[model samples]
Target: MKKIKLYRPIENFNKNCSYEILVNGKKMTDLKNGEEKVIGISNELGKLNLRAKIQWCGSEKLLISESNNIEVIKVTGNKFLNRQMPFAGGLFPLTGIVIFSGNSELFKNIGIGILILLLLGLIGTLTIWKSRWLKVIRE
Candidate 1:
């Protein structure tokens, strides 16, 4: 991922300022005034010089005005998942369990209810894993 270091020259305007980081004129994040501490971008965006603006200012240090048309620099780096293994070992056992359960006859004579329960559990686990991985990437 690329690392962009931005310095906001304006200070004491209020902690509640609405800041935006725009890459080549595209908006990335709309953060709370206080939340405007530091920002990072993915490597896909490459080295970018962004235009930032303080869109709003609120009462107290918690309230600050937005910045406009400010230029910032970005440094390029390796891809975010470059260090990830091509084959993740953690998914093997789960895959085996899913494949094994598809042949229901192996668990026959035990009762349809038991098989249904096992299938439901496997489905739930896969759903959770998928959602969790998606969340990690999104952040």
Candidate 2:
């Protein structure tokens, strides 16, 4: 048996929501924003499947071995990604439009367009994009 440290830094803008940790398709524990938790893993299991749940199909699965002393796994999500459906959906586009429209004339068309696209792409990670809302990495 071994131990793993799961951490979620404060950089995630969606502070209100917490991530549910899963080990080998079984739920282990949950971690709030800026929180860390230590959990036991079975060495016998070998090549365990580790993942975090944001809401739905949260993140990509991570394959890890239990031979390490203590693996520090970090999970993170993009900013402005904790939006609720229907309501927050409309608000996001409106908010983007407002910001784009309010920008200076010099950067209105090109700069604002690029900024809006970037933000939309990031937000899409939670939905249509191939990437997930949360990213899992080892430190």
Candidate 3:
């Protein structure tokens, strides 16, 4: 599997337009108008570019004609990286509350919500406690 970055140079691409990508003189499949990805392999080292219409934003995966032969390289934009959340010290408490408040009876007539809540609460508490104790011992 190889990673290749693709750039679109067209202005205002319509979602209904077809795009083409070629690799190593082999004509690749025409990308669907709403397609976000088209997989292709590179035999020579050059500008591996793609011509496609801009589809809707925020879609994660794209289907390519040569999906088996091509691997789509993920371009890590700032917007993508910024979505990661920092390790919160509140995970246990928040999860505990959620489990305790959620409808566990929905799982069955048996009241499993309390059990799940307790389990999550225990896990969260243990995690927080371990972290705090580790810090104290380190200090």
Top TM-score hit: 2
lDDT per residue for candidate 3 within 15-132, as digits (tens), equals 3454344443344555443344534354344543432212221122333343334444332212211222123333546655555665774533333555565566556544543222
Task: Put the candidates in lDDT order, highest first.
Answer: 2, 1, 3
Query: TM-score rank, highest first?
Result: 2, 1, 3
lDDT of 1 at 43: 48
- Candidate lDDT values, in order: 0.38, 0.76, 0.37
* Candidate 2 residue-wise lDDT, 1-139, digit = tens: 7899999999626688888899988999999989999999878877898988866757889988757689899999844454433245455555556557764675455555666775686577546853466788989
> Model 2 segments beyond 4 Å from truth?
80-131
Count of clashes in candidate 3: 0
Error of 1 at 1 (Å): 1.5
lDDT of 1 by residue, 1-139 (tens): 4444444333233245545556545676654433323455554544444544443211111111133333233211112211242234445455456546666765443445454555665565345422221100111
Models 1 onward score TM values of 0.28, 0.64, 0.24
Stretches of model 1 off by over 4 angstroms after superposition? 6-10, 31-38, 56-139
Better of 2 and 3 by TM-score: 2
